[model samples]
Target chain A: MSLINSTATEALDLLAKGQITSVALTSAYLQRIADTDDQIGAFLRVDADAALARAAQIDQRRQAKQPLGKLAGLPVAVKDVLCDSQTQTTCGSQMLASYRPPYDATVVARLKSADAVLLGRTNMDEFAMGGSTENSAFQLTRNPWDLNRTPGGSSGGAAACVAAGMTPLSIGSDTGGSIRQPAGLCGVVGLKPTYGRVSRYGLVAFASSLDQVGPLAANTTDAALLLEAIAGHDTQDATSLDAPVPRFSAEIDRPLTGLRIGVVREHFTTGLDGEIEHAVRRALDVYQSQGATIKEISLPHSKYAVATYYVIAPSEASSNLARYDGVHYGHRTDRAELLDELATEQKELESAGDREALKNIDNGLVRMYRRSRAEGFGPEVKRRIMLGAYALSAGYYDAYYLKGLKVRRLIRQDFDAAFQQVDLIAGPVTAQAAFKLGEMAGDPLAMYLVDLYTVSANLAGLPGISLPCGFTQSGLPIGLQLQAPPLAEDTLLRGARMYEQATEWHKKKVPI
Target chain B: MAITRADVEKVALLARLQLTDGELKMMTTDLSQIVTYVDLLAEVDTEGVEPMAHAVEVSNVFAEDEVRPSLPREQALANAPGRNERGYLVPPVLGG
Candidate 1:
């Protein structure tokens, strides 16, 4: 085993004991990333300079006898979607390729204040659009467990990095299973907190009502610790909760007795692969052994989660993305002149134009705007953006957006009813293990279907988590999802901690 | 009915994205397939059921009326691809 392949908790203990200096640990991971990331493509941009400087600052603080934050000096990878002022914050697209945020995102600033070394920015689906990192415009982040398979996305890179030991902890966003799906495929723990638990001010918009930032780590406790650091309220984000952040790690090891884990009858039906189902069933057995009761419950609207998510997410995305028309912060050029057929576009550009205008302008800018966004964004992003625009258009708004909102209410109602009978929901995190990179490429519906089991939590605005339940027949990892009602991450985490304590899946690492 | 090539092209233009003929053909086929797949929702009998917008029943997620600090002008302008005396520099806004 590589000495560097340690859990976040172990790494912190080492840091506190002075067994490894922050600089040394950061450099070791940076060097490891340098050696392996070319093959894995986990990092979009590795900021060696900032990482080392942050480490040195932490070391200086240690020598000065300053009180260190619990996660101080640990190197954690930031997903490119979140803003990091000192680093190039590209949301894996050329639109924001040169776009720099004037200030760090709330989470990044929090990490900086805690003296954590921001290791680098990990790759993700452009605008967090797809289920595979394949949607990344820059590069594909492969599953480290099986290099040819996808790590799952849009947090694929974060999960891949943690699984491969490139970093002990990484943060990823989940509007609809972006964090948990990747974590499941990569054999790590990913948590999607209740909506508004984490601030979204610095995150590039995808689906505002659904988007949340969370962490991916090797184990449940590490995932909880990372969440504790970033899971508080900020006045800047209206959606941020004003509630106190829970002590996630403190109760992780708490007993699972008396916890009722409901196995969703809909989650393990004809569509789910047998291997993944068996894995989850095995995980359920562990909970039963731990004095937890398992009950079969039905979530009637569960079947509609993905369809509801697609419509609702696209509708929200259509509106939120209206600001990026080669105007405020993204791509720009001189496409002032327009053909008669393009008069509508001309009017739009004129109305929304920022002061970057020169006296003479050609169709070059409109062309560039079209081309850059076309070439810069991946297929999934384009699909959603188009779908969104159509849905939000005046003609289709009621049919699509409004209709989707009502269905969303039903979806949430389904979860509320289920939670009435059970303390929490548990099932396989995904229908299957990680597949080869090209396995589902070019099939957008298939990609969306992968989130069938996970999207309901987002629709319900409930907190959910995916932890390593088992490996598939092909030896790829599978995830088992545990969900709780709003503010019930403690129960979900506790149940996961108990199962993890009984299993060895969390201890397995990729050969890389 | 299947989504036509013209539909795809029109949607692309609305998104301010340019698609080549080759891509148009590909997307036409892909979108038709996706639309057909999503047509599964049509069978769900959603007449009286309201379409869901947000999962939670949150009505208004409003930031308080407070004048918090904005990022400094220079810092905000730091990443602008082009800039002039007043602000971000670009081409003419109107035609003669």
Candidate 2:
């Protein structure tokens, strides 16, 4: 296999036997990124000098017979949402365009401890707010399969880089369908670990209750390896599960006998493209041929997933994003004249000892907060903030945000009941293959509908994986999503692997 | 409830975002449509259901009150757009 196309697992084997050096592997990927990233727009920044330097250090450690971590010498790309002090962590927004975190996110710290070569930061939706990477304030990441279509987002850059062979593995965050949707569209493997399975410390907060970090790779084994390396409890993230981390890569190949896969009756009824439904059915047939039974399950409350997610995610975002008021470490608008006027007024009020009057006057600080955010955030971000504020506002809280939460309980109940009969749930990751770049640009609601089948997993806090099942007639790849009960990542990966082994979809390379 | 231009303006102010006239118009239309779409949730029978604030059941993750090393003042101030020798500089808050 070409060095650029080798999976992380394959490259690791070569490094272990001394047949190849980390420098050679890292350089190949760096070179590939330099050549193709201009067209794909998958990466926001590539630190060639830093990556080469790290690769050399790992090579020397190996030569001296020093012990290495699980992902020693492999190159990994991280979504810009994860903080790394060495580079600017722009969460694809101008609000954080120049913000460099003082410390590494727990996941980035873990990757460093594993001795993985940090290649670069990939692009994402601004604050992970949009379904497509087009919301990125910096650049638009195009699908490698067809440049005219979207790569699926907000982890579009992470999925695109892996699919386009720029990196063997990349880390992505999922709030709703950010990771799985893009991976499905790009014809790669993407896993969204159960909520709390991975720590969210250092991850730029989007929707705190739903955000999760996971891996995107060329195959399930690579995804498993990356997950194993990053999964564990951390003191920094209160939501991080205290349970022991499972060796997912080691257990991935174990065959799952008498697997009961549930197919939701509602997932196929409306807005689903015929080609995607057919492809997912064939994937189910592959499992059936392997002696697995497909059972029809009803998650009746799933129809409300998109509606519930829109309300709940935005409400949390409105509260979490209040900290970026330009007072600390993000974009601050320039209002020199207003500040000067306010300063003069404050001096006069303090000298006169008019404390009550001083407290009532307009300070310009509130105006600064408003203008700075207005200048920093994009249209979709602004819309969501407005929606969220309105939902959580005084009179409307119960009608919107509270109602959404109650419905969320119903959605979880639907999944809990389904899991009683089936070990896993299978469906299409997206309603259709990748859409054209501007197809849903003017319509935010239409764009949200794309996440219809995938949001239920995030809402229910379940582990979901998107595998390359087949392709559309236009050659756009289709993803078959398998969701397991919370913390059942082992079963999720093995189930995905079974279908992967039976089909040749994963072997198909991007035309880029 | 329909989202009028006034509603959008009020929400934007509450969210600390200053939108232009064109943005306000666009947001009014868009938010109205979104609110209408989500109104379907009102039809779901959720009586006696408790509101789920989080996906997982976790609460009061307490840690010992021992002091640990924290970021140096300089490092913390490094990304501040406007900072003085001691701390961040911002527009006057009280009267100034």
Q: Which candidate is the best by lDDT?
A: 2
Measured with C-alpha atoms, the lDDT of residue A471 in candidate 1 is 86
Per-model TM-score versus the true fold = 0.92, 0.96
* Candidate 2 ranges with C-alpha deviation above 4 Å: A337-362, B94-96
Q: What is the TM-score, restricted to chain A, for candidate 2?
A: 0.96
TM-score of chain B of each: 0.82, 0.92
Residues B19-96, model 2: lDDT tens digits = 889999999899999999999999998889999999998989999899998899999999998899899887766634
Give me the overall lDDT of model 2: 0.92
C-alpha RMSD between model 2 and the true structure: 3.4
- Alpha-carbon shift of residue B79 in model 1 (angstroms): 2.7
Candidate closest to the true structure, highest TM-score: 2
Candidate 1 residue-wise lDDT at A74: 93
Stretches of candidate 1 off by over 4 Å are A1-3, A333-372, B45-52, B58-68
Task: For candidate 2, give the docking quality class from DockQ.
Answer: medium
lDDT of each: 0.82, 0.92
Give the per-residue lDDT of model 1 (tens digit) for B8-29: 7778877877777877888788
